[model samples]
Target: MPIISKQHGNTLLITLVILILFSILGLSLLSISISGMSKNEIREDNIQSQDLSEKGIDRITHQINSELTKKIEENNGLTRTNFINLLNSTVNKYKCTSGGSIADSNGKTGSYNACIKEVNPTFEKNKPTVENELRKSIVFESKGKSGDSTKILLTEIEIGAESAPETLKYAVGTNINDKDGIQDGEGNLYLHGGVSVKGDFKVDGNIITRNFGYAYLNGEQWIQSLLPESIPSDGSTNSKLVLGKDSYRLTTNTGYNNHIDRNTFTGSTYSRTTDMKNLFSGEKVPKIVQRDPVISPIGITDQKANFFLISGEYYSTGVNKIPISNVNKSSSKIIPTYTERTRECVRGFLICFEYKNVDTEKESGSFEMNGTNRFNQFSTIGSLELTNSNSTFTKGLYVGGNLQIGNNNTTYNSNNYSDITLDGPIYVKGNVNIQGANLKSNVLLYVEGEVKIQYSTINGKPLTDGKQGSLIIFSKGQIKISNNSVNQDNPSQIKGFFYSEQDLEIYGVGSNIRIEGGISARRIVLNAIRGRASDKLFTGATKINSNDYFEGEVGQKTRESRLQIIYDQEIIETFSNLKQPEPIIYKVEPPLVKERKI
Candidate 1:
């Protein structure tokens, strides 16, 4: 009985040890299962965070593309401020919760924020490069967080260059869509007498030709010409001109038997046949549109005016003129000096004129020539008439009304002591009558009304010499050059860019007219033919006809007039930096993801 008792005790001890081993094994298995579950959760969270980050980037990109499409359709450009506003608005749409957390549609709780890192733009020759060559890149970064997982995405977007405004691209452009033929007839563009254009020629309506009426273009010529009697099929000798939805007309009332130098007519000519549509499917009529800038007037006080002349109305009679000693001084109130302020005000406005109605009889003023005077920039709300004045304008001039330089028979001769130098641009809202004056190099004149140049000298020296100058004249109305002649001794001669929205007429009995610039107009008329011997020089029919008859015989002794215009390629840059179209997002970089342990 004692031996059996001892063996039972031993067996009980072994059983207890086995039970302990089993408990240890069970605890180890439980721990392994929990570890696997935790790892799986971590992996799923990481994926969710990554997907949230990618979705955030995609959403921002879509928003940007949509906005850009709208801007492009509206012909608007995206500025830096506009881009920042877009990002801020997008962030607000995907608002986070009170604890700075939000759940996506996929039921994953995460937070995302985006910011702009950089915006860089590249330029060429001081002008924006072509769309393909333009370099405008932006960097965007997005961060997303979900539970203990966080993901970051970085992206880069390249924006395409903005195209130039159509109005600025053409040497002569108008927005007249004269459905009725009345306005169209008066607004017809005319070309004649060795006229040349260095850039494209665009007109909104019909085009008319006068005697020897031909336009020489270094670029393209877009005209809505009248259709010919019969259209020709494709032939080597056949006219390369295509019939559009418009018609063409000759000044002589003749047919389309006009001659064009092969070298000058490198571009295709299109005319409209019916209903203002191109007969040839591939032919296109370049349209001329209008664009106006916002006018914000700057306010001036007595103190400000004392430093720089700023006035709503300016009048000078006799030998009185605005003195130049007052300009570019220090202002007592403004933080910046008056010179700095004046530069800032006029820097954006090379030329500016605002039209305002004034009593011509009461407000008409003139500046008489007496002594030499200097001015930085001059602007007026009314007409500006200069009579025998020797003035030097260093910057620019703007007149709300007419700009008359000299009177009839008043010769403007520049001597060593007495000279008039217009160094910058001139803007006139009304008529421009320049009887005799000397325009320095790189001078530009823009008129909103009629332009009459009786006698003038442009660029008193040759282009080879550093003293040579260039001139550009733009007119919204008719342009008439009567009895005008260039300098005889100057190699630079008269280089002029004469552009008219309406008719460009040149009338001379025997005087020689030589212009080294270009001429772009709606209708160009040249009446250089000598007056008939039998015809009376003076006509007694009407008042308007009497002046024409008197001036007719004044230049009759010469018997012939020589008109020449040679296109200059250097003036092309003068019209650069105009308004441009909106930019486009061309390329988008793939989103880069980075995981962070939180």
Candidate 2:
């Protein structure tokens, strides 16, 4: 009976040991399960915090874009500082609530706080401080917080000019109506043969091109056409080529035909246009038109003249021969002979003057030269003619009527003897004719009428140090260059600005025409012809040409004349103060976001 009792006690002890082991195992499993749940909850909270931070960035972007759009719609201009203030205000409006918590539209609860850590505004290089509207970019470094997670987001915005028009910013701009390539079409702008523009190429009408032409705005190629269909807005179409409102198109045909080769474009053909406009505003379109620069006539008086050679009452019955020279002799009051002339014999030359007379109807003044005429100044009321003469003026020449340079007679082959030089400013109220005359000057030639430069070498002095003048030839009427006026010896070396209020025509068989400075005109026509009628296409008028033929060669001769217009930054900058189109901003790179742990 004792042995049986001991065995029962041992069995009871074994059962107690087994129950203790089971209890320990159950507690271990419970602890492990609780730890796993806690880890999952922590991970989920971290993910939500990151998402909140990203949301903060997106929210700020949307707010800023909306505010900018509103400002643009109001036509209110903003400076760099003003833009930054707007950004900061928008960011503060979308900040997290008091408890470091914010709720998204999806009912997801998280905490997010965003503040602009850094503000950077970019301005155009080499521009004046007053042109701060030409700011290139503005960057905002923002920090967002959600619980223990944080993120750093970089937002960049581009800025542009407000008063300038987009179309006028190009090297060539035309406001003429070009319907079916006629009407105001004579003034149409043309680009061809490796032409490069530093700025944009804006045209109110259609564009016509035959060779390759490239336009670079701020060192970037501009390839998109300004057609309505090319624009990003929903209501864009291919109707009117809106000035200051559309992109500049490049094509070989007048209407939208063979556009610039896509391979030549810098970015996607149509993408950059939308991207550029987006940088300005998401809602409202940018301004297009602006005032043009005013050009006034330079004033002159009789006190500035040396001698009044042509009296105001004198009328030309025929070609009058007037001998002008600096030579003066006390012995002879009458004009000396042309053969026995010496520089030491004269103190100064005679100057022609004609006052505004209404009573007497004077015939067009004509002059025939017997000898070399040197003068300090020359002025005329009626049309002044210089046929077969060697003339030189040191100070100025003001012609109230037409100033004919060479003989109009086709049979007149004395062009080699026609050498003219003017050192100072030349103001002509009528047309300027340079026919077969070798003219050279470092002067400002301003013409109120048409300018014809044909079969001559017209060299303008380049701007140099200590020389404060620029070779500016401005014409209120058309400027025609025919039969190789540019010196072939210096080929493509014509420097300075050549501007025309009317159309500019470059026709005739000549060497490669290279205009170095800037060419701004109402319209530009480029044609290659072997006859005179083709030259009249640009002049907008008909005049008797000595070399007229019954049937002339009129075919598109592209190889004979290759036109090149290279943009000169210095020259363009000098004229920046003139009225122009506003600039458009765009983003070059994407936004960058990085996660941070706190």
Candidate 3:
């Protein structure tokens, strides 16, 4: 600090001031850069967290679904409870989330947390969602952490359930592909004799209608009330059961899902278009009543007069069967349709009747009935034949062998028509044959063998009453309902429940095959063709469908369809009490899945 000129001093002071200003500006810029970097880091973390969350959930769901499919295939099937147990075993959104070891987008590591919970099902209101197990759902959630930032994603998976319509609820529910691994027309159905179903008709395989099958699903209203209500419409397909025109030719192809054969089909493939369940869904249909060891009063010749079947009284057979005849005692030969089963009562009708004293024909230890008494819960160990007219059977009957009803010697008429009346819950362990005028019933026939019905009128309660009234037949073998040579202008009402593990066939010519209830079989054949029918009414030149005819759908009694099916609550309730083999669970359909950010 020696000698200084005034001008030089001023210049030095100015220089010092400029330096101070530059220093302040540099400090400010440094502070700003640090703040910006910190903010950017937070933003990057948030973005990565979201991405990780998304990826984590996707992987988790994909893994779970894949595992589920594998399990079902491995186990053949898994009950709802079992499925849930498996779902719970998927702990820690994959093991990577366990120790904060999951890879982040920035090559960093982060942890994820996940959870699953069962929630109330979201089903449509006022709709009949039967056997859906309350339409429950499982909510899945996962959170990904990145740089202290977390993102959560959630998804809901809903499973669907249903009882096999043919087994209990529907007029017809058939799984034709049960016997064969393929679905090549094995489950096809043909409607004939103007035969129609008045209820819902479901075929799990396919319908092989040559002349075309008619089924009137009540259009929009019907769809709204029925199952289609829950399924979304794919604009490409109509909601009706399209009886494809090329099936007769298609039966030759021995394969499943031959899309080329039914490519033009515009029918509903059910609600889940996105994910259709596998037909080999590892589940079996529910049985009506299994042949278990139960008490019955039908046989047991050792218990004489021990149990009196009073009129309108319920009785058990105590694991035996009732002999239908007293003359042969061990014989029953009342047959025209099921004559092949004739053995014990093989004597001439008159010869057997000679020793038949209806009054004092009681055996020492046999279950006996006097006069025209009515009884329920009767069992027959052998063949049971009914030639008596205007006969009525109530409640339940178990036939361990064959059962033949109606007079094979005479045709049924309004006045001459033999009426063998019956109510619900009957089990026939053998074949069944009946030839009558009005085969009416409010019953369920669970036949272990074939069933043949020559002439039938209306049976049981009428559906117009808007109540549960009709007949339901579930056969383990083939079923046939047709007209005899004497049938003409019968214009019969073929309503009730018909199900066959094999083919369910209905042959009609002269009669308007108008059927209510339901008909279900592996293959349903309705032949209303007039090829063999003549235009004659009981020798009076009765009316017959002399040529090919199409009234409406293949299985309806009136209106649009030749066949239709209506639901019945009474029948469903009946199944709840029926004898079961084991704890039953219907098949589980693939779930509808949805996801979103939480």
Candidate 4:
């Protein structure tokens, strides 16, 4: 009996061991299955999130582009409110909870909170969380949790071509480099609207901006503000515009106001005063002691007519001298002792005039003014020629489109109260003459073709008042401003002349450049015209200060008054520091994405 019991016990033990082994194998198989399922669900969720994020970006981009195009077409500037409204209108995000959901789609759900915050709305906010929200509606939120049986599905609907809403939607963000550092590549940046740069920046593409355009010297609040309110400490350490120092030049390697010997600088690089007048038409300066300050009053007659202007105030005397206020300054001083003196707006000057004879001027058509009653005026086309002839402008030439001039001696005239504003590019192909005492706005002179001045001059007569304004003359081709004829405005404000914010590009090797007026360009190609070199005897006596001169920083009160920075693709995609996850592409496209229910 004992032997039998022992054998039975052995058999039972073997059975128990076998059962334990099978249980272990079964558990392992179950674990593998669960892991595979979880991975599949995770992949699906990521695809949906990515799609939704892309859709959000698309909607935002469309709004930006549309707003910019409209602003340009209407000849108006863009505002922050405009951007915010567009964002809110384009995409409405609500919480996924039943109480928060709005326009919910599929089973995928989420929530959104208005991310618009306010700093100095006038200036570019520092990594503005609010602005970013408006620009990019989807802020990344991670998806992870404690152990549990949970599956999430996200759907995003991008406005793609042939897919419901036909919008050109492109995803832009940082891509991780194999070396780990993020690359600010163009591919990652998206340019939907016009972008401007207010600070000194190194870019990889052509930049275009309009109305109150300028580039700042640095990317800092204090630098942009130019006021102690931003940086209470010594403000002199801030970067200011230097003509020749700091190895600065109008164009790369091409010195500022330097003599071009072979389209390259030969003599010492200098910003000559004569070059200043040539680039910008105005009166000659008085030779004075270096660092001497001078202030001259401007004359004005009318009170009903309103006038505003932008001018430079030089605190120094003579040429190439630092400002007097900058003498013996620490590293934090804005500028050293002064060398030259220039100021604008001696008095408020208004531009207003009337022309009674219209039938004689417009023989072919009738044009309507925006505010005034119907009156016929002399046509500006082919009517006035400067063979030493007196020409008068009857009305303010307000431009809604571009103006192009052909090869011919055409005299452009404006009365003491008349002004000409090139809201768009003004292409001149022949010898063009301009005369006006009160220029309230700016003039764009682009000579893509030959331009010859028959002893013409831009002289600001009635020089008793020592005020002048600014001007810009740009030529992509041959140009010569050598006529003795005068072109000058009344001395009432510091005037800016021929200050192009764009890099000058010339194709022809025979292109010659000669300017008796102020000339500002991104670049200058003296050899664009091969034989035109000798013809280009750019002779003038005015000093040229290329690059926008820095004025410490404007206070918060003048944030919108100055040029604003452009948020181009490079700025968006290449912004320093902010890192985003790599775009997760999917094998199977996710379902259409919709805003979460509010």
Candidate 5:
């Protein structure tokens, strides 16, 4: 019995030893699982942080581009107010990086950090600043980097004044040297009479002359701003500043008789407004009126749609008739399409085309130059119909006739030294250096974008008439004029609005009132500058400062578009990812012992 008892006690001891071993294994497995879970959480946070950093950079760049575009449009192309608004709203914020956390488009939070530095930049301001003078820049580092996170944004801006030319000669006369096709080394050009230039004219530099000069620049043309208005928001058939009726204003009737398929018609959509008002508003649906049945210059279309009629010259108050019958005897009354083959060179020259006689051929409708000289000329014995036809002077374009410029920038030269009439408006997309001639138009002499000139013999007199200056600078976009006049001998006193998105700089002398979006200059030579068209001549600098001016802060907390936002630097919530850590399982094995006879 005692021996039996001893064996049982030994078995009991063995059972207790097995239980201890199992407990140890289970604890080890639990520890490993916990460690794995912690590591997984860290990894997930790292990925999210990286993603948030990238999005932050994108958001900032978007704001910058938006502000720039808005300013250019609202202020007629980047006025002082727009500049100030952009700087204060965007650049003033933490540019390079900040220690605070920035939320991304996904509403994810990540720490923002960046290196900030102001780099010197030579930038030109679209307008004069509150402190009148040439523009200065505020350049800063536009990139950021951290361990595995990186972000970048590059931008620059400036403000300053450019000197205006003092004298401009030969604003009127006849047959002198045709400076239209001259090179930059020939010095600033001036023309005043009937002119003709034959060559591949190229003005490698700035070409300046009086706007009243009867002249043209001759070259392979690269006219940019043909029609520079916003597409109409209202559903209208017209794409320009004006809309026409059922019949194309310039055609006998807006119709398609050509055998070509309808698919052949390709052109940019023109709108009377760009406000997006046609979407759901009570705006009337626009009936399409073919303005350009065929597009040539710039290849926007295949042919000229219809002839634009000058209200005062061609269309009488009683009945408006399509003049196609006038050209039926010569060729197709339809206007020919002249595609622009000019290289995308930034510079070009100008030339003038004049019909030798117009009295006898007044009833004619179409005129074309078939000559093949480097520069070609077409003349008529009477008042010929140069209408409903397209002409492209390989160089600059000059017109002096009852001419009409299409919504497109055609390369046709106008007959200089004649009473010029325009059915539509004259579009000066490139340089418009008029020497001397009366310019009459129906709508606006839209530049579409920029305007640079050398001199002005506007009205062949001073701008003191109409109780103001002689010239008017107007636009739906922006305007820029640089005086390159060299004839300082008798600098004509000037008047007009140095109107633009920015300030106007006038560097000449005389009596005049000036209206400008902004004014900037190092030395105004008060005798040469003026303010309001009614304000007395500015004998000195007429400096005015905006009451709502703000500069950008390179590293600070600022609101975007004046909206409130919070800047924080800590994580507000934490989470654990169990799936990220592979499960840690425990295993048990039976211990082996020999059952021996006791």
Candidate 6:
């Protein structure tokens, strides 16, 4: 009985020890599970906090950007002073001390604070501040927070004028309204070859150019509102651009019969307008002040001189008059005789023939020159024609009546080659016709009436000597260029700035032509259709040149126009010479973003 009792006691002791061990193992497992759950909660909080901070940044950025866009739209452009004011207004309205909190329905929350400052800018006190000493930037700071996460963001927006685009720097372009291309076509433009233009053309007409050459077209102010990657909203067919073939490609090899393929028909889709309109609007042409001659020749005042030599120092419209009416024996023309005998009439060899009598009633006594001639300073009241080739005029010519220039001069000695040379300013009141003349000189032709040029080599100085003044033609009436390369000895180039209050026209001959310079006009017409017409095709009033290149025909795809344009800086820089108002320009840079975590 004593032995059985001892075994039972041992079993009871083992059971007590086993129960204590099981309790310890269960307690350890429960502790491990609780620690894992706490770690998961911390990870979830971190993700939510980071997202909230980013959301804070996005909200503030969007709001500020919206305000900037609105201000720009209202003012066309924001000046430096105006921009600072805007930034201050925005900062006051939205900025917060510490931070402003934002909570979402999902229990995610964020806080944001904003501040703005200018970066390294110097401006004159109380002055209009036309120029900026150093490029300025608007820097923005945003402090974003959510839960335990915080992020500081810095954004920089640059301010100042940007370099003008290649298209906007053309020496030639049309100056008209933006919607005119849609509403009226008043600002129509047509060009080919290496074409470039300023930022004012609104033409909807199909422009033509070569496949390889560049077509640079800068649209109007409002047209630039759309992003570069976006197209016009209306999506009209007229807005589409079509470029012509390089006539030089098959120039001699193909004739009217053998033409180019249809694949060469390319379109101009990369037209870029600028924010410059909002920034700067050029002033209109100033009023012209009439300038009178310095001295009047005593004896020749009674009779109206056809071609005269005036002697004296002069201003814009100087008249020291002498009539060499019967100088040339060939035709009944008045050619200005340049001799030491006639050169004595006026000082500085200044000559004026009836300059002040430009009234329409006094349009009689037209002057004509039939042979080659050369003269110094000259001005006339009646119409004058340089009929024969190789005529040279130094200084300038101010005419009151119609002038016919550059008749036929095939052979002439020039470093870059020219049949006619007008080495100075040309001012005329009546229509001026330049026919079949290769002109080589620096010309600033300002005409009150229409100016027509055909088969001419205008401003074709050699590249080395091209520093001469550009060929600037400003006409109150329409300006037309046609059939330039009828005889394709030269390229029939017209370089420099061309402006017309009315329409501008360019016609395609069998050969190619190039125009370099800034051009501004109401509208443009590019007629690439080619055909031949006999002398009997027109009436007696229309003078017929047997070698006329643009008689007109139904334009076929194979036979197209070849044209090009380049260089515009000279136009913008020298437009004041035409008594035009100046333009102010600026540009906006992409924002630079920097971020930091705390």
> lDDT of all predictions, in order shown?
0.43, 0.43, 0.44, 0.25, 0.25, 0.43
- Residues 458-566, candidate 3: write the lDDT tens digits: 4444434464345566676778775543234334544455666666766444334545445656666554432222323222222213422222222222222222233
Model 2: lDDT of residue 567: 45
Clashes of each: 22, 12, 68, 98, 79, 24
**Candidate 6 lDDT:** 0.43
User: Alpha carbon lDDT of residue 268, candidate 4?
Assistant: 41
- For model 4, residues 1-598, the per-residue Cα lDDT tens digits are 8999999999999999999988999999899899999997777665555454344434433443454446423633223344445434433332232232222234333312122111122112443343332233232122212123222223323221111000001110111122333222211111111111121221121111111112112321111221111111122232111121111122122221222212222234322232222221113211111221111101011100111101111112232321111122121111111112222321222111222222221211111111111111112221112222222212222111112222133332223222222221133323333332222323333333333332222322222235322233433333333212112212122122232222322111111122222222323221110111112123321111332122222222232212112112222222111111111111111222344321
Give the alpha carbon lDDT tens digit for every residue of 1-598 in model 1. 8999999999999999999998898889889889988988888778777777766666665665565546534633344344445534433343332132222444446666655444444354444563223334545556766778888766665543322223333333333433333342343444432232223344444443333322112322221222111112223122122211134423333322232111122123432233322321112322333434211111111111222224332222222232222223121111111122233335444222223333332322332322444455555545666644544444446565687765444432333112244444566767888766554445566677798876564453233445455566767677877644422222225655666666676633223454554565545444332222111244321112222221133332332224444444444443331101222222222322222222
lDDT of 6 by residue, 1-598 (tens): 8899999999999998888888887788788778877676666556655555455556655666567657755765554456656655654454444243222334445555555533445343223364343234445555556565556655554433332222233233344434323323353343322122322223223222221211111311110011011011122211112111111121111111111112132234322222222111122111112222111111111112212324332222122232332221222122232233434445564443322222222333555544455545455556777643444445446576787777633332222223565544566778888766667645666677898876555654443434544567767788887646643434555656666766776644333455556555666644332222222333211112442323232322223234444443355333333221112222333333533443
Q: The CA-based lDDT of model 3 is what?
A: 0.44
lDDT of 5 at 118: 42
TM per prediction:
0.45, 0.41, 0.51, 0.30, 0.25, 0.40
* Residue 239 displacement in candidate 6 (angstroms): 14
Query: So what's the TM-score on candidate 2?
Result: 0.41
Q: lDDT for model 2, on a 0 to 1 scale?
A: 0.43
Compare the candidates by TM-score and give the number of the best one.
3
* Candidate 5 lDDT: 0.25
Clashes of 1: 22
